[model samples]
Target: MQLSGCIALVTGGGSGLGAATARHFAASGANVAVLDFNAEGANAVADEIGGLALQADVSDEAAVSAAFGKAITHFGSAPRIAVSCAGVGMAARIVGREGKLSFDVFEKTLRVNLFGTYNVMSHAAILMAELDPLADGERGVIINTASVAWQDGQLGQAAYAASKGAIASMCLPAARELAQSGIRVMAIAPGLFHTPMMEGLPEEVTAKITANIPFPARLGEAREFAMLAEQIVENPFLNGTTIRLDGAVRLPTR
Candidate 1:
């Protein structure tokens, strides 16, 4: 789809991958909405890109609905491109030295990563369906973020892996259902990237993770993720699939 003059909504647009995508979209002439739980961060990014910043929690239906409403109020229409990038990661073995993982921890991860994506996508699709179709009867595109850990998780990533795996597993069915409405759905399962999730790790641990990347031998950049999002939006035929942006790196079982 042509991005020029299009309206785009990016959840988790306050930081990391979401922020990068928001900036890219704005640079491409799209009117962008930056939505995040961190209102300050969202506002900062929005100011930089001349877009609207909405405070919202993707897991909270009311908050997400309100934010979308705000975006429509400000932009004069529903966003044609909606990217669900709001998620969290939790590392814990289902059964380890700590014994059984806390149910709360597991549930939180699933709620934010899996349900949150669904929440935003559902609302976005509803709005997109109401909009007039573009040149090729295309209503809009939805992009979701998954992780390579969903497929090749190492030790202590049960919650994170399961949440991401759910996203990857749902892409095709969701895309198929939305196809009738001219709405394309796709997912990106990213490997190690330079995001806040990795920033919390110790230096040595981060370096070890980077060493696993066979080619570039480093962490993926947020811009790389944004580039793929742009491509998925532009390539109409690329639907109902999950693309792995890991630089050919697959994690080993530890």
Candidate 2:
């Protein structure tokens, strides 16, 4: 579906990829809603883009439902585009030192990354199903964020990898199920991007990380990710898959 004149909601819009996407959607003529757990950050981005700001923990079902309701009330319609980017990247080995189990870390990672994406997508699809279809009977599109670590997960990434892996694995089935409702589902698996997570790394450490990437041999820009999201929204046939935005880099085991 075309982005112009559409209503778009982006979770985790307070910073990083989501922030960039919110701005891009607004620039593309879509009425955007910026949702984040960080209320202040959400407000700042929304103010900058002239879009609505919503605060909620994506993993909280009631909070997410309420956020979507508020967005609908403010925009006078449900979002035609919903992007799920709110997630945490906590890492831990399944069996850490001293026989400490990482169950808590695992549970939290899945709750925020996997369950959170599912919550947003479910709500978005429901609302989209009620909307009038656009060209090709398209009602809306949902984009989710996954990580290259899903497949290239290094040591100390069991929790992170499993959460992201579930997202990647859900793409096709979700698209198939939502197809009947004229809603598309897709995911983006980004590799080593220049997000807030990478901000505090030492220069030498950063260099070592980038050395694995081919070609540009640097971190992917947030805008580049936004560009791909736009491309997916405009291309209806690009559903039911996870597109890797990594610079052709397969991560190594640490």
Q: Score each candidate by Cα lDDT.
A: 0.93, 0.95
Candidate 1 minimal-lDDT segment of 10 residues: 94-103
TM-score of each: 0.97, 0.99
lDDT of 2 at 237: 89
> Candidate 1: deviation at residue 140, Å?
0.4
Candidate 2 wrong stretches, greater than 4 Å: none
- lDDT tens per residue, model 2, 81-159: 9999999999888898999998999999999999999999999999999999986899999999999998999999999
- How many clashes in candidate 2? 0
- Supply the TM-score for candidate 1: 0.97
How many Å off is the CA of 29 in candidate 1? Answer: 0.9
**What tens-digit string does per-residue lDDT give for candidate 1 at 1-254?**
98889999999999999999999989988999999989998999999999999998899999899999999999999999999899887777787675765678789999999999999999999999999999999999999999999899888888888999999999999999999899999999999899987898899999988888998999999999998999999998999999999999999996
Clashing pairs in 2: none
